[model samples]
Target chain A: MSNRGPADTPPSEYEDEGRERLSYVVGLVLALLLTTGAFAVVWLDLLSGGAALAALGLLALVQAVVHLRYFLHIDLARSHRDDLLLILFTVLILLIMVSGTIWILYDQHIRMMA
Target chain B: MTLRGIVGLLAAAVPGTASAGSFLEPAGPIASAQFSHFGVISALMLIVIVPMFVALPIVLYRYRRGGKGTYRPDWEFNWGLEVVIWGIPVALALALGMALWKHTLEYDPYRALGPEPLVVEVVALDWKFLFLYPEQGVATINLLALPEDRPVTLRLTSGTVMQSFIIPRLAGQIYAMAGMQTQLNLLASETGDFIGRNTQYNGLGFATQSFTTRVMSPDAFAGWAEATKAQPAALDAAGFAKLLSPSVVSEPVLYGRFTPGLFGQVMARFAPAMVQGHGQAGMAAPPAPHQGHHHMPEAGR
Candidate 1:
């Protein structure tokens, strides 16, 4: 019903869809890279031991953040901000619970052993 | 609603040790108390965990596309409810934590929890428990004998990687770490054959890592030890090496007339620093002509 020809239509919608698809592929590649990198760090720690284990654990945390941000598309969108915040809070709680258990148990063991 | 249905669901969800197994019976009072503590803690946790799981689906379904309520975008926070929910669990956890701490101290392995305790030096080899009795001067592999009502102290260390020493009726699992020793105190009120095993997965032989425990009268234990000890002259270093060789299925062997300080020597081998003041300082070294100067026992022959 438009008076203008089909050539006059703006190409912004096609460009937007293409960008969404490209972001998705980038997200997939990032997820694979982070996962494999995390595994490599853990494997190296197993072979080397000691400080490598600490380093591996730290890398794992970073890789988990990378996965959540890029692969999961957890970003600055207002609608999804609450979901991202909840996830961050959950991760914090889990870290606190796990680290607390290990610290308390290790302390108790040291005292008993001494 | 139905207990059987709930049990079925639980069994489906958590397999392995959570379900019934032959290895869970207590060999002593300490183990029994520890098991009870675990049970209480698990029960308490289920009260919160089960409700959370049950509410998950309800919340998800209610929030789905075509639900009844007028969906309000402005609903932000529920601070009071959050505080109440989290506060109760925190209080409960603190109370449980204190109870466990007190009990753990009371049941400390180094302290004598009972009278006339039997001491068993447990060496976790490739896949077995080597029990050495210093007082009796006898050593046995994969077999343990103890007199009922006596407190049993286990001095545990691993030959290789870390392993967890566990005998359900005797006490909770304690670590058998390389270059380190862990002690567990156990007192058996009843006389029976209980099983002890490694709870940690170390390597290929881990699945078969187990030992037989017999709680008999003092006279019976002495008789059993004497019978096993009097078998033959398998007491030299070569004989000891043969015994120590890794095996998947080794029949129980006992040495009645063991060298007086074999236990100390074994301890020194794994943990050299701990046996400093225990008459091991001035004692002559190994019979082998190795790194240090010591009296050498004739090899095997």
Candidate 2:
């Protein structure tokens, strides 16, 4: 507990220079724009039916990726290999769950309709 | 599961209408099938769950302070054990998936049945069912009538939010999503009032989204249709708008005549022709070129 001293700490001046204040502002604005765009597609009923559904789905997928990359600071260089593998596995599992649900339900549709 | 929790779950799932000589049995085919599937899955999981519950105490006892057992600190993953663990589930899922696939196809309602059963277009709204008997040129809201012993095919859609079309005695609960059609086939063996309701929760009026399904003799059904047609006015576009207006506990209303191709018009309102063509392709004659060309890769390009 007694080993630390004020002179051993790095100055705050170096940290401030590395931070991109302008890029942070731009990233925030872009994120807001993407969110609004997603909302507009849904609110306007732009696609309707299957196309509309797929479009909204794609929008959500892209938005999730964007959030992970930018806001969460998840990237190839910054993240460990295990972290990237975990994310990939998680995405694969999610896809399997969603697609399997749709497939089984569609089959049920065919049967119930028959 | 505790007895209290299981009781609560059952109570929550079963409707209050069960004791009133309800139209359909609460624990019918779909409910039973789902229950059986869940039971099998849970039973298999219990193989691990129960053992863990038991072995956990034994492990704790053996590993206590100053315990007699020797410690092995350098343990690696057991590939054989992992293979056995994953293999058992994969095999079980494969068997279950196959069974589900076979049963699902066998019960397909829209497939061509004997003599092409009667068509009933059902629209579930806030708290009622609007049944349009296209072939009979009749429409009824909050009341469904069908002749006993005849296969009845229901084409279901929703006016707004998603709903589930469930007739417990007849078949499974299939979702009725807005602007999207889902089909169901059912036949009543005995003549009676069958309960039809929206199984999925929508909004405030969801509790009352129920209707009476009357299974009548062929002669009685014809008489009922005649009586309905004898009403003062027929259902038109404006009339439809009025019927579609969200309301609670709507009274049964019937119309002798409905606008021609009314269902198709409703289908087109939210979807392009190509979307409609997806379902109607094999059922009816090919859709018109201009309408069907909306999303087809060959034509859209």
RMSD of each: 14.8, 12.0
Error of 2 at B57 (Å): 5.7
Error at B156, model 2, angstroms: 2.0
Model 2 CA lDDT for position A59: 69
Q: Write the per-residue lDDT of candidate 2 for residues B149-254, one digit (tens) a residue.
A: 7777888877667788877655667887665677777776668887778888877888887888888988898899888888766877787777667788667788
Cα deviation of A58, candidate 2, in Å: 21
lDDT (Cα, tens digit) per residue for candidate 1, span A18-109 = 66566677767876776777677766554344355555566666766666666665666643777878887998998899777766654443
Mind giving the per-residue lDDT tens digits that candidate 1 earns over B156-263? 766667788876666667887765566787777778777778889877888888777778987888888778777675565566566566666557767776666554
Question: Which TM-score value belongs to model 1?
Answer: 0.59
Number of the top candidate by DockQ?
2
Q: Pick the candidate with the highest TM-score.
A: 1
TM-score of each: 0.59, 0.56
**Candidate 2 residue B283 C-alpha distance from true site, Å:** 22
